[model samples]
Target: MYRVIQFSTGNVGREALRMIIARPDLELVGVHAASPAKIGRDAAELCGLGEPTGITATDDLDALVALGADCVVFTAQAETRPDEALAQMCAFLRAGTDVVATSFVWLVNPRSADAWLLDPLREACEEGGSSLYVNGIDPGYSGDTLALAALSLAGSADRVVIQEVFDYADYDDGEFTGVQFGFGLPADAEPALMATPGIVASIWGGSVHLLAEAMGITLDSVSDRWETWVTPTPIDCVMTKVEANCVAAVRFAAEGFRDGRAVIVVEHVNRLTPAAAPDWAYPPEGRDGVHRVLVEGHPGIEINSHVGGGEISETFAGVVSTAARVVNAIAAVRAADPGILGVVDLPAGYAGRVMS
Candidate 1:
């Protein structure tokens, strides 16, 4: 069993802790949290593990790393401040602990990180002999791995498209519901303000680009836009201007090409509220989370995947699944090149266990 140290005590950390408890291949070695309320708690208790495992939380960074953990799973707020987070991650890697993080900073572009961030971390990992990686549900899996796996069904294809739609009302995060989707905003608010600049692109762009590269298709052009409107009331008990309750619709499309020939196209949508269309699935009703993968091949094939959604447990599970994949990818940490690494570099059918 791999001894793992988890960073932070937020939703992601808690979710990961739950998976470790059930998986016999991994063990929870320690937990580091900034919250004083969580600092002294057992890792298992945080996830309702039924009994304490004696692995209490700690605020002491040095002491936490000294536990001789095989790896560290970081789900901290570095996503809001990626540069600093990347540097800190490098420290853990250099200390001989393989690093697995879902931080947004490292997810952006491994090369874009500051010299101070990558230099020491790379050296440390090289000397200590370890590896590091960053990932998340949206950019990491639902958007990338699933899409790539579907593409393999066709021997050859001229184009591929992956689409995802999420109901905003089902989401309970204050920041996500209020700002990101413009759910509770006034009816008179401008529609342009509903979609935050770079936020939507940051989430899906990486996946689209990665898939294109893996397919050997050069991306000719990419475009993204957001649409928001006030709903008459709220459909399906949702309340928003974009829809009856408060729904914001955002769509992204990317056209790929090879030598000036269009080879692929990808389009996706993030719906925050309910829609008037009878076909549009709304959360709390029919299938809330649904994904459709369509391949335009010699014979044309399509696969429909229906995923259920409900409660905080489901939300935590989706987010935690991404972290779990990163942890399972830890065995190959040593083979990972210095600097930031993404899911694309990850081996296919990775077994979600040891990296090797």
Candidate 2:
């Protein structure tokens, strides 16, 4: 069994903890919690599992590194703290622990990553002979893998568009909804860092590059565009109130051009409430969320993924899938060559066992 340590117990991290305990091939060695209330609690209790695993949460970074576990599942939030997240992952990698993370989305394709951001992690891997992989559902399976798979069925492809459409009303992350995406701000206000110049390229650009590489197509340039929609009426959600004329929805697109035309594109339509942006593309059958991959080709193909159903909200389902993508890749990452690894570097069937 591979000894594993989880970095946090947030949305994604909690699911990681549950999967770790449920998998017979994985053993929980330690867990780290940023909140004082979570520290010293049993791992199982923290994850809401009935049984106790005797592994208590700790805030001691040194103790976690000293565990010398086989791998560390680092799912801590990196959008607001990229530097700190990088340092933490590097420290664990230098301590000889392979890492599978959902924090740094750019690492999905390290070769396309910023040199300054990726070089240190590469050095850490060399120093400790450990490997690192970064992935999540959007920039992960839905962006690169699924897009590429769909393109394979095309006889001749001209453009590829991958889109994520979701209603974030039930997503309880106030900071993310209010600050990061500018969801509750005035419609005319500047967008969050994600929609700013070069940010989307830095995050989702790797997916574009990955698809181009798989298709043997060269991109001349990449660009981004974003727009916001305002609610005409007041809307209520778990996070905050969306008063009239406030930012209610955001639509952003990042495109890779080939010979002056877009050949690869990643687009997001995120709305705070369903009523806020009723005209945006939604899932078939009135589903709340969907990830769609469209390949414009001789035999054009469109693949849609609608994950959550019943009581499961789209946000929670996304969180769980993100964690599963990282956890499922743990074994393959550990067995990979020491360095920054990408989806293309690993085998096709690295996803862990299926659960009914």
Off by over 4 Å in 1: 105-124, 187-199, 234-249, 252-268, 272-285, 308-317, 332-340, 352-356
Off by over 4 Å in 2: none
**Model 1 lDDT tens row, 1-356:** 78888887676677677766667777888888888888788888877787778899888887866787888888887756766666667668777788887775435334434466567666877876777777766555655677777777777777776665555444555453345556545556654343655545545566657667656766765445555544556544232334443444545444454567545544545554445333443333455555566778765767655443454434335555656766666666545665456666667766455322
Q: What is candidate 2's lDDT per residue for 236-272, written digit by digit as tens?
A: 8976788889988888888999888989999999888
Q: What is candidate 2's CA lDDT for residue 204?
A: 87
**Clash list (residue pairs), candidate 2:** none
> Residue 29 CA error for candidate 1 (Å)?
1.6
Indicate the worst ten consecutive residues by lDDT in candidate 2. Answer: 186-195
lDDT of 1 at 110: 48
Model 2 TM-score relative to the real fold: 0.96
Residue 303 deviation, candidate 2, in Å? Answer: 0.4
Judged by whole-model lDDT over C-alpha atoms, candidate 2 comes out at 0.88
